[model samples]
Target chain A: MTAAAEFISVSKRFSRRAKVRTLAGLAGQWLRGPKRGPDGLLPHEFMALQDVSFAVQPGESLGIVGPNGSGKSTILKLLFRILRPDRGQVVTKGRVGGLIELGAGFHPYLSGRENVSINGAILGMSRADIRRQYEAIVEFSGLAEFMDMPVKDYSSGMYARLAFAIAAHANPDVLLVDEVLAVGDAGFQLKCYDWMARMRTSGRAVITVSHDMYAMAASTRCLFIKSGQVKAHGDARQVIEAYLTDLSRDRHDPVLETNFIKTADGVPRAEIKSVELLDGLGRPVTSIGHGANLMLRFHYHAAEQVHSPIFALTLFHDDPRYPLNLPRHYLFHVFSGPAFADQTLKGSGTVEVLVEDVRLPVGCYRAKTYLFERDGVSPIFVQDGVARLEVDRPDWSDGRPLLEHRQRWTITSHVST
Target chain B: MSPMSITAELREVAGARGLAWMLASREVRVRYKHTVLGIGWALALPVALMLVFTFLFTRVAKVDAGGLPYPVFVFLGLVPWQLHANILSGAARCLTDQRNLVTKVYFAREALPLSVVLSALVDFAVAMTVLAALMAWYGIAPGPGLALVPVVLAVQLALATGLALVLSAANLLYRDVQYVLQVGLQVWMFASSVVYPIPRTGNLKWLAWLNPMTPILDAWRTCITGAHFGLAPEFGLAALISVVVLVAGWRWFRRMERVFGELA
Candidate 1:
């Protein structure tokens, strides 16, 4: 069967600056004589998407995952015809609907009932179509009582619901949804997800471009793109796993590039110079399965005598959902017993932490090591990426768990006489 | 880019005309919403301009009215002039003003300019009612030439639609076009025979009739009095020019629209 929507080797480009050509600018170009680049693009033009291709079958939801400036939104805009592809053809079999912008054309002065008609029309529905769907749209939005009030009077959540209701009722054969679900209340977002699932079951194609890994895993298939090229495609969970692994790898680059404050008061305080994750045999490891012994080693140096210095180690998953809070959040933290104020050191040395049975569930985890004040509260030196850890899902495990808690349940039945 | 594709795109745009009409109606409704005088504001601009010109021409310039009431005479000119000016100014900024809609949504982009034309039509309809009231107050009766108003109106609409398309797309590209258009229209108004009596036959007639609006404004007044109104013979030229402008403007808009989102 043919795909509901397909990209056939599509390529799109943009100038270094947006192509705002005034008469004077055009005249200047004319006088200077134009030159073309290797890709047949004008000078200062760069290809945003370079011959990338993918498809979405009917009844399939495809999620696209990528970093910023990764040409993900460019694909949606090309498919929606807001931007035309410069090189290849983008084919869609039926009416295309975009959830790219919700409540975009709404006029503050217009009532909700009135904005329905205009917004519907702006979404490419006809007057007759809007009239037919008006009742259903208002009913689904759950704003039936507030339809006559000015849109400005509606809360932001109410506004999103109404906008979603109209676009959902547009009943498109292929929908291009671009991060619009990130807005609105959680309950409303779940409702929209339910609606999209229903549409998928009814044989509609949905292409979602979002950073939500969980949402991507829920799709039938996924495409992983980076730097204008396809890195991986097919099997939503696998694609998402690949994306996460690559993201953690990229996370290591910044740490190696970061310059740590190695000295305090022009004298070296005990500081962690390097870190390594080791196994039972003292071999360095990039990853290992759960339920195994793991060792963490920290290399340190000190130029002067330090009293009761404490070392802090912490572990956590790198969740893309909370980009700003990723590095600072810690799932578990531990400190040396030297905080009792008895231990003192004044030379280079190594410290080792070992766990007999690792309980971290299957996920990518980064470890951060810091040198704290004698009180073990204020950090004197910090390193973001001391070690990168991956906890693999064992063959016996049914599904990935947040924690590998060991538990058993016992039940006894007593007959009542 | 080909002729065939142009026809196809135009057919699609025709299908999206309903979107344009809805947006236009929404604009008209919003303009009147929560206002004290409401539609009175629509009538205010044309009437106020008519009063100003009446003062300028009758009291200051001491121009002859040649038997027609000065207020009635000037308003007849204001009706078409206002529609034309409103459309040009409105269309010139429609794309830039609604950059959010333009960049994110995909519809007939011509609809942006077309909606402005439609909203201006609403304002023009309101202004025409006041013109009728003014005509009644002056005791001027309808004549056989009243039938010719639709013809004059059609040519006027064609010109307005043509210019609307051009101004909107041009403004998106240059941005300077928006400011330039404001000053251009002001000069253009003085150049046309909007408030003065047209010379019958002379070098001054040549200068006055050379402006395309001269014939349109003349035809509007002569159509009221049931006169031949064909002396300038520029009506045929203006009609031809309107058609040329509309087709050319449409082509120009289509050529520039593919870049509107990225650049605008």
Candidate 2:
């Protein structure tokens, strides 16, 4: 079978215009002749994608994982024909649909029903096709009762739901979905996943761009891109592992250390020197698997010793569904041994928190550290985002890695004649 | 670099006709959503302008209406002028107003300005009914030249679409185009023969003939009044100019289409 989409050694460059004094300067250049590079770009230009190539076969899903400004979105746009490749050929076999931005064509004053047809057409569906699938789109959105209401009055969740429903029903042969899965509620995301699975079973190709590890792992193959080049490709697990290793290397660079300190109440008597996340073998790591041994080590110095000092570590996940500052887990330990019992023990030391069989889900978490007195009312030294930890379940193939708890239950049936 | 030929671009635009229609209806629907008079506003503007011009020119300035009722003659001129002005202004800003859609989604870029022109046409069609009633009130019976109204309107649409495409694309590159257009429309209205007839014998006769809108507006008046209503050489010249603008402006617009997203 023919490939659903293919990019043959594509390269794209974006040019920056040099400031000219007036239209005369432009006219002078035109009279003198064109001064452009071989790639049609002027002197001041930046390469966005360089010699990038990939292909997606029918019924297969390809996930592109990359850092910001790594030309990930550019690839998707080229595939959708939004942007032409500067050098190389981009060939797509069939109808192309994009979920790049939800509710992109929705008018605030138009009713949900009206918006469904309009958005569907924008996604490349014919009017007759939109009419035929209109009821199904409304039914899938679960907004049948609110179809007549203008979209501006609807909550954001409802608006995204309606938009996604129309796009999902358009039935393109090749689908390109950006980082839109992070929107809406968890149930809606699962619904989207189910729809994608159905599309795959029906032999359609999919290309997804996301930072979410779980979503990348669910795809059949993955590409790890950095600085407009493909560092690794093929085998979702291997590519993801390579990506994680690269991330850890970047984070652990000595020059890249984060200086998180909160000394608002004057220079505190205590200071947190450094923080590290360790794996099962006591090796420093930036990511950990679910139900694995993990350790968090904090190094600190105290100028003046205090009694019954409390050390706290808070883990926060920047969940798109909630406020940024909310912490997912909190742990507070009071040092009551000889280290803290002394009335005035001034020295430097290390504190370690060893967790066995970690159950945190697959997502990036930030650790915050604080030192307080015995009463735990006043904080001596507080630091936010002292360290970062990424949790994952590399073994799971389907469903999100949300938890690791196991349940024990038995069912019994009783019948009476 | 050129991505596709003009024929290919036209084919792509043809494929997006459904989207253009949907967008046009959306513009019409949203404009009248909360208004009490709904489509009555479309008629009110031309009628009000006609009344003001009739009082100012026919009475105050003592300008001749070519022996025709000044109200009917001015109404005929005002209807098409409003169509041209509304379409050009709306199309000039359509791309900027939908910047979000332009940057995020992929569709035929021509649809943006074309839909604005189409929506303005709906308003023009509605306003023409009032023109019909006014002509009947003056007892101006239909003539053989009435069939030629469509031809005149077609030429006007061609001219407007060409100018709209050029202005919209240029506006994206430099916003000064929009401000210039606002001030330019005021001057352009007086240059055309919308309010008073051009003097047959005067130093200003050459100026009137030089204005492309003059012949088009004169052709519309001739068609409505059925006096001196045969095909004029000036009308043919106007048609030729409209075609030239349409072709050249379309080529320039297509060449600049690739950079619109980045500039926007």
Candidate 3:
């Protein structure tokens, strides 16, 4: 048998102003343009889906993992036929059902039972067919008592339950889901994930787009999409590893390139461009071993006069919600003077703050920069979300501590019988 | 999903009469529930239209329904015409009316129109009952063709359903189609021989013959008029047209089914 779904070199190019062009272009093709037709007559074009091809066989659940705006949802839409492809074709060999958008086919005025029949039909069921499966659909939706009530009266969870019940009970050969588990409460999310797992076991080809790595790790077979293209198309574990590595690399740049933070205005606001955690001799440091010296390098450029500027660095965990502020002992004070040294200072300068035998917990952290005048006015410039650093502490085979650090973690492995 | 595989699923929608009855009852109950006169409105509508047309055509225009009282003739055609008009229009916009389920689940797409048609059938039956009472008051004895009314109505329904499927699918992609159909139905009601019968003319009769509704409505008039209306030929052609439209609509719907999820 042919594959459950096949995308053959399918590419969709969308004009930036396609909507405007479509409206205006139809009005008059009778007019000749001076040079081109008209500037706004045709919109700019860009490819949303590239010349990508993939096949999903029966009993395979493919997880699409990618960065935001990497055409993950577009793939699901193509499979669902929500939008026609501009190029190539998507051949589906089986009945296709989608939980693409929740509560899509419901009528506010219609009762759950009435909507179910209509919804079932839209999903390719007959009236008689929906009637036969009516009880099952109602039970699954958990709206047995409320079946007679109109859908407008349903709560969001009830709406999702009804929607999910309809899509799942459709029993289609191919299932296209996009972040369905992203809705409702945690319990409902888990329920949907469980249903997906059962669907995978039933030999139905399932294409799911999700950001939840744990769910992908548990249920999917082929992890195919990472940042729009197929990073690892076979093993789920390997693909996830590759995706995570890419994510880490993106967050932590190796070159330690200087990124200046400007004031609210677009002018060359701050004197110091950026400051990054670098190793000895000004090399970028990432995942430094516990017993190594770490240096915080400051790259500064003064567009105009700098008056008694003070550079301050604060360390905290990566999460801003509840940052674990570093102990003051971890701080290595560098050059302390009349801030910018002189009110006439106007050139580029590099300042390094070094900490020897740097030891912290094995985790990722962010370094914040603040610039202030010697008069103790509020810091003129504060830049955040700029830089990140990772600390790695090696461990032994028996789960015992291996790497030497000023502070040590004591633990004993209790063998449970 | 392949159309062949969905047949079993489609058949199950109509298998549960209770389910159909529940939906049908909801439509009926809701319409009359808040009304002071309840279902009297259903009877009053046709009676009122008949009286108005009877006065205007008989007294004002000096028109006649082949020597029969204008009220009775108009009433006969109006009963079936109203049902046909309501079902066709309602079912055309049924899918858009029920976008919630279409976007979410896998169900038979035909059920939306089917239920609306089913609900309107209840209204048709209620109107027919009032027609029976009016015929009795006028001492219009029953004829042999009276028994065939249900069969004639069934054919009318199939044609309406076929039209509904096409319009419903079209309405999903184009808003103007539904808007146009709403205006077209009123024009179509007058164009067909619903109120006044058109004398047999060269292409006029043929034009009426081409309209699937012409034969059904004409045959309905003949049934009550006790006239020899050779409706068999027209009915056959209309039935054929209904089937063609039905199949064409289904094919178009299936072809475009995949894109529905994306666009919708």
Give the Cα error of residue A27 in candidate 3, in Å: 7.0
Instruction: Indicate the residue-level lDDT of A79 in model 3.
Output: 74
What i-RMS does each candidate reach, in Å? 2.7, 4.0, 5.9
> For candidate 2, lDDT tens digit of each residue in A159-213?
9999999989989888999989888888999999899989988999999998777
Residues A15-69, model 1: lDDT tens digits: 8865666788878889998689776888888789988899999999999998988
Q: How does model 1 fare in lDDT?
A: 0.80
Off by over 4 Å in 1: A234-251, A256-265, A278-295, A315-328, A337-339, A352-366, A390-417, B1-7, B206-210, B225-233
Question: How should the candidates be ordered by DockQ, best one leading?
Answer: 1, 2, 3
Q: For residues B134-208, could you state the per-residue lDDT of candidate 2 as single tens digits?
A: 888989876788898999998998999899999998888766778889899889888888887765457877656
True contacts kept of each: 0.68, 0.38, 0.31
lDDT score of residue B72 within candidate 1: 79
Cα displacement (angstroms), candidate 3, residue A248, comes to 7.2
Docking class of 2: acceptable
Query: Chain B vs. true chain B: TM-score for each candidate?
Result: 0.93, 0.95, 0.88
Model 2 misplaced stretches (Cα beyond 4 Å):
A15-44, A253-305, A315-357, A362-369, A381-417, B1-5, B200-202, B229-231
- The candidate, 2 or 3, that scores higher on DockQ is 2
Give the alpha carbon lDDT tens digit for every residue of B208-233 in model 1. 55566778887888888654444546
Per-model clash counts, in order, read 0, 0, 40
Q: Evaluated on chain B only, what is the TM-score of candidate 1?
A: 0.93
